[model samples]
Target chain A: MGDIQAIAKQFTDFYYSTFDSNRSALQAVYRPTSMLTWEGSPILGATDITEKLVSLPFEKVQHKVTTFDAQPSSPTIASILVSVTGLLLVDDSPNPLQFSQIFHLIPDAGSYYVYNDVFRLNYG
Target chain B: MGDIQAIAKQFTDFYYSTFDSNRSALQAVYRPTSMLTWEGSPILGATDITEKLVSLPFEKVQHKVTTFDAQPSSPTIASILVSVTGLLLVDDSPNPLQFSQIFHLIPDAGSYYVYNDVFRLNYG
Candidate 1:
C-alpha cells in the first residue's frame, strides 16, 4: 500500500513549485491521456493542457495550500486521488483567490502520471 | 463512451437533493471501500460516512452549483471524475459560503458507487 499522506505532501510541493516557476515544465507529470477541467472548460491530452497552462494571462502566480487529502483508489489499480484547497496569488496581487484542485494519479513504470485534473477559483 | 455532462448533471442533482432531504439515504451510493475527506477530516465506509453526515450540526442546507465538469478516466478501468464549485447555505444562514467537491465514481452491477469524495468550504 502506498503512503498516501507522504505522497500527497511531496506531490503538492513539487507540483506548485514547478507551477510557480515554470508552468510549461509541469507537463512532465501528465500523460497523453490526461484531462484537465480548468474552471469548467475541458482541456484534453498532455499537449493541450500544457498549452493552456502556459497561455494563462497572469505573468506570476503562487499557490499556498491550506488543506489537502489523498486516498489510494481501486484495490486492483495503483491509483491515487488528491484534493487540494489553496489560495492563489496572481500577478503579485495582494488578495489571494481561493482555489480548489483535484488530481488523479496513476502509476507508470516506477513513477506516476496525472490522469485527471480539475481546477477552479472559488470566489468569482 | 459515457456521457460525462449528462451524468454529472444528473448525479449532482440527486446527490444534493438526497443530502438535503435525507442524509442517511445517501449511503446507498457508497461502499465499504469508499473514503471521504470532509473539510480535511477523513471518513471511511458508508456507515461511518452516513453517521458523520447525519451528525452535522446544521438542520438545513442548500447547494447551488455554480459550475461543474466531468470526465471518463482510465481506458482500461471504467471510472468517472466529477468536480463541482458551488455555494452552500447552512442553517438558513443568509450568507452563502463557497464550496468545492470532487467525486470519483466506479461502476458496479450496472450502477455506480462513490469511491472517493472530497469536500471543503472555501472561506475560513
Candidate 2:
C-alpha cells in the first residue's frame, strides 16, 4: 500500500497552490474522463470543470486544510478526503466557507490525475 | 435558518435504519434524478444506485457516524458532511472502514431527498 498521509499533504499543497495562482495549470491534473461536483451541481470532463474553477466569483481565496485523510482504492489509485475552512473575497467582501472535498487520484505516467472530485460548501 | 444540527441527527437515524433493514425503502429518500458516487465510481439515477447498494459484497454492515455537519444550501436544500467508521462482514471476515460522505439534500413535499451523494472509504 502507498503512504496515503504523505500523498494527502503533497496533494493539498500542489492543488491549492495552483488554485490560487494559475488555475489553468490544473488542466494537467485532470483528464477528459474526470468528474467534478461543485457544491451540488455536477460538471463533467476536464475542460468544463477547469472553466468553472477559473470563473468562480471570487476575487481572491485562501484555503486552510483542517483534516486530510486518504486510502488506497486500487493498486494504482488513492482516495483522499479533505476538510477545509477558507476565506473568499468576493465583490470585495470576505466570507468564510467550510467545506469537505473528496478526490480519487489515479496514477498515470508516473504522476497522479484527479479521476473524481466532489466539493460542497457548508452553510447554515 | 433551519436547525441544521437537529436535522443532521434525524437524518442519521433515518438513513441507517433503512440501510440496515430494507435497502429498498431508500427509494423514498432518492429521486430518479439522484446521483451517487460510490467509493470513486459515479452511479447516476436512483434505480441504478439502489441496485448497487443492495448488491454490496457485504452480507451485513453497520455504520457508526463520528461526525455530522450540515449547512443549508438554499431555502429548501441542505448540504451535509459526515464522517463514519463502520464494520462490514465480507466473505465471513470482519473489517473496519473509515469514510467521509457528503450529501446534498433537497426538500420535496414535507421531507428531504438526496439530490447528490458521494461516499469514499478511507484506506491506507
Candidate 3:
C-alpha cells in the first residue's frame, strides 16, 4: 500500500503536468491498446486519444487535484481515481471549466501506464 | 439534453439527502441488478450494497458536489458523472474525511436510478 501510494502520487503529478504543457510527452504513459472516454464517447488507441488531447480548444489549462485515491485492482494492477477542479481557458467560453477525471493505471517494466481513462466536464 | 440535466440534478439532490438522513430510502434508487465498487472491491446487488453503506464507520456525512457532468450514452440511457469534495465525521477521527464519488445513472419510467457507482476516499 505504501508503494502504491507513492507511485500514484508521482504518476498523477507527472500526468497532469504533461497534460498542461506537453501533451505529446504523454505518449510514454499510454500504449496502442489504451482506451479513453471523453465525456461519454469512447476513443480507442493511444495515438488517436493523444491527438484528441492536443486538439482540445483550451490553450491554457491548469488542473487542481482536490482529492486523490488509489486502490489495487489486482496483484499487478492499480486503479487511481482523482477528483479535480480545474481551469480551462477556451475560445468561446471565457470562464474556466471544472472537471473530474479517473484513470486506471497498470504496471509494466517497473513503471506505470494508463490503461483506461475517463474525463468529463462538470456542467450540463 | 435539458431533460437529462434536470433529472441528474434532482437525482443527486435526493440521493445525497437520503444518504445523510435515511439511508434506507435509497433502496428505491437501486434495483437488484445494481452494482457498486467501493474503494477497490466490488459488491453486487442492491441489498448488499445498501448494507455496506449503512454499516460504514462514519456517523454523519455530507456530500458537496463541485462538478456535475452528464452525457447521453444512448437514446434511452444517460450516464452522469459527478465530482464531489465532502466531509465525513467518524467516531475515531476528529477531522472529517474528504472523498469523491461517481455515479452512472440510468433512466427508468420517468426518473433516473443508479446503475453503476464507484466511491473512494481521497487519501493514501
Candidate 4:
C-alpha cells in the first residue's frame, strides 16, 4: 500500500502552491487531460481550466488552501479535498469567499496530479 | 498513533449514519459541545445544529457522505472532511446539493466525534 499521508501532503502542497495567479505551477500539478466541473457544468480539460481560472475578472485575487484531506487508492488514484478561501480584488467586495473543493487525483509517471476537481461555494 | 484509516472510517461512518431524518445517529457522532458554523455565523452546539438540520422545510430530505479524510492528532484531535450530497425533497427542486465539509474532530475515550464542522455549498 502507498503512504496515504505522504500522498495527501503532496497533493495539498501542490494545490496551495499553484492557487491564485500561479498559472505555471497550476499547469504542473494537473494532468493534461484533467477536467474541472464548476456548478455542475463540465469545463473541459486542464488547459481550458487554467485559462478560465486566469481569466476571472479580478485585479488581485488570492487563494488560500485552508484544509486538505485525502484517501489513497492503489498507488495512483487518490481522493482529495482542497478547501479554499478566494479573496476578490474588488474594493467594495466582502472578504474572501469560502469554498470546499474535492479533487480526484491520479499519479502520472513520477509526479502526482489532479485528475478531476469540483468546487462548491459556501453560502449558508 | 491511532490507525488513520480506521479513524477516517469511524468518522465517516458516524457522519453518514444519520443524514436525513435519523436524528438519533446524528446526535451520536457529534460532540455534545460541538459547534457548526453555517456560512459565517456560529450556530452554537450539537443540539442546536441537529435541530436546525431536522427542522429544514423539506418533505423528504436525504444526506449522503460522498468521501471522508482525516489526519490524526494526539489521541484526541483530528481533522476530517465529510464531503456530502444533500437531496432536497421540494417539488421541482434541484437534484441534490454538493457540499464539502471540513471537520475538526476529537476522540473522547474510544469513540471519535466531530468537534467543529463548516459546510461550503457548491454552486459554482
Candidate 5:
C-alpha cells in the first residue's frame, strides 16, 4: 500500500516536474511500452510523446494536485486518480487549466512504473 | 461520434437517476460483468453494487454534467470524460459533490455498453 502511494506520488511529481522540461526525469517514469491517447484521436507511444513535449515551446508549467486517490489492486498493480490545476507559460502568458489524470501502475524489475495514463483537460 | 456522446449521456443520466432508488434502471446501465472499485479495498460486481446502493436512504439526486468529452477510437470502441456536480438529499440534508467519471465504451451485439468506469469524488 505504502509502495503504491509512493509510486503514485512519483507519477504526479514527474508529470509536474518533467512534462515541460526535464526530459531525463520523464524518461525515468514512463516505460518503453507506455502510450498516451489525447483528446481521443492522437495515439502516441513513449518516444513520440516525449518528442512532442520536447518540441513544444512551453518553458514552465506548475501542477497543483487537488486530490490524489491511489488503489493497489495487487502488489504489482495500482491505480491512481490525480486531479491537477496547471499554470502554463504559453507565449509568456499564464494559461491556467484543470486536468484529471488516471494512471495505471505496474511493477517492473522490482520498481513501480507507469503503464498507461489517460487525462482530461479542463478550461478555467 | 454522435452515438458515443449519446451513450455517454445515457450513462450519466442512469447514474444520477438509478443510483438512488430505481433498482431496475440501475440494472439497465450496468452489465452483470460490471465491477466497481471504491476507495481501495472493496471490489463489488454489478449485483453487489446494486444491492449496496439500494440499501442506502438517498431519496433524490440531480447530476449536472459540466463537460462531456467523447471520442470514438473505433467504430466499436469509444472513450468519454464526464465531469459532474451532484445534489444529493441525504436525511433531508442537501449534499453537493463534484465528481469526474471516465467511461470506456464498447459495442455489444447491436448497442453500446460501458466496459469500465472509474470515478473520483470531490468534496466541496
Candidate 6:
C-alpha cells in the first residue's frame, strides 16, 4: 500500500513535469497497443498518440494536480488504476481549466507504461 | 473494441442511475477487495463503500454524463478502463458541480464488477 502511494506520487510528478517540459517525451510511457482518449477522440499506438498530443493547439501548458488516487486493478494482472484531477493552463492563458484524467498503467520490464489513458476537461 | 464501448455505456448508465435511485444496490458491483476513492477519501470493500456513498451529505443527487472514454486494459486481463466527465446536481441546487470519475471493471464469473473507482470534483 505504501509502495502504491509512493509510486503514484512519483509517477504523477514525473508525468506532469515531463508533459509541461516536453510533450513528445511522453511517448516513453506508452506502447504500441496503448490507447489514449484525448477530449473524447481516441488515438491508438504510442507514435500516433504522441503526435496527437503534440498537435494540440497549446504551445505551452502546465498541470497542477489537485488530488489523485491509485489502486491495483486485479490480482492476476499486474496493473495500477490511477485517477487524477488537476488545473491546466495552456498557451499562457490566464484562466486555468479544470481537468480530469485516468491512466491505466501496466508493468513492463522493470517499469510501467500506460495501457489506457483518458483525458477530459470538466466544464460547466 | 465495440464490446468495450457498449459495456462502458451500459455500466455508466446503470451505475449513476443505481447511485441516484438506490445507493445500496451498488454493492453488487463491488467485491471484498474493491476500493473506491470518493472525494479523495479511500473506502474499502463493498459494504463500507456502499455505506459511504449512501451517507453523502445530500439526500437527492443526479449525474449528467457529458463525455466518457473506454479502453481495454490488457490482452490477457479481461478488464475495461472507463473514465467519465459529468455535471452533478445535489438536492435542488441550481448551480451544478462538475465531476470526473474513473472505473476499472474486471470480469468475473460471466459478469463484471468494479475493481477500482475514483471520483473527484473538478472545482476551480
lDDT winner among the candidates?
Answer: 6
Q: Model 2: per-residue lDDT, tens digit, B94-122? A: 55565557665655677777766767554
Tens-digit lDDT track of model 3 for A1-124: 5776687788889988898788878888888767677866677778998898898876777666755655443322344433333444454565766555776576678677776676866552
Q: How far in Å is the alpha carbon of B102 misplaced in model 4?
A: 10
Q: How would you encode candidate 4's per-residue C-alpha lDDT over B1-124 as one tens digit per residue?
A: 2476576666666665556547545766665567665654456567888887666666555556554444332222343333443432343466666566666555568666666566655543
Can you tell me the DockQ of model 2?
0.05
iRMS for all predictions? 1.6, 10.1, 7.0, 9.2, 5.1, 1.0
Query: Which residues of candidate 4, in runs, are more than 4 Å off?
Result: A74-94, B1-18, B22-124
TM-score of 5: 0.59
Error (Å) of candidate 6 at residue B99 is 0.9
Q: 4 or 5, which is superior by lDDT?
A: 4
Winning candidate number (DockQ): 6
For DockQ, candidate 1 versus 5, the one ahead is 1
In terms of lDDT, the poorest run of 10 residues in model 6 chain B is B72-81
**Ten-residue stretch with the least lDDT total in model 5 chain B:** B73-82
Q: Every model's DockQ, to 2 decimals?
A: 0.70, 0.05, 0.08, 0.09, 0.16, 0.88
Q: Write the per-residue lDDT of candidate 5 for residues A36-66, one digit (tens) a residue.
A: 5454434445677667556655666556666
Q: What is the lDDT of residue A47 in candidate 2?
A: 96
Off by over 4 Å in 5: A20-24, A73-95, B1-17, B20-59, B62-98, B103-118, B121-124
As for candidate 6, its clashing pairs are: none
lDDT of 6: 0.89
Off by over 4 Å in 6: none
lDDT of 2 by residue, A42-95 (tens): 687789999999988776776666555454433223444343333333344555
lDDT for A9 in candidate 4 is 66
What is the per-candidate TM-score for chain B? 0.95, 0.83, 0.82, 0.71, 0.68, 0.98
Better candidate number, 2 or 6, judged by TM-score: 6
Q: Assign candidate 1 its CAPRI class.
A: medium
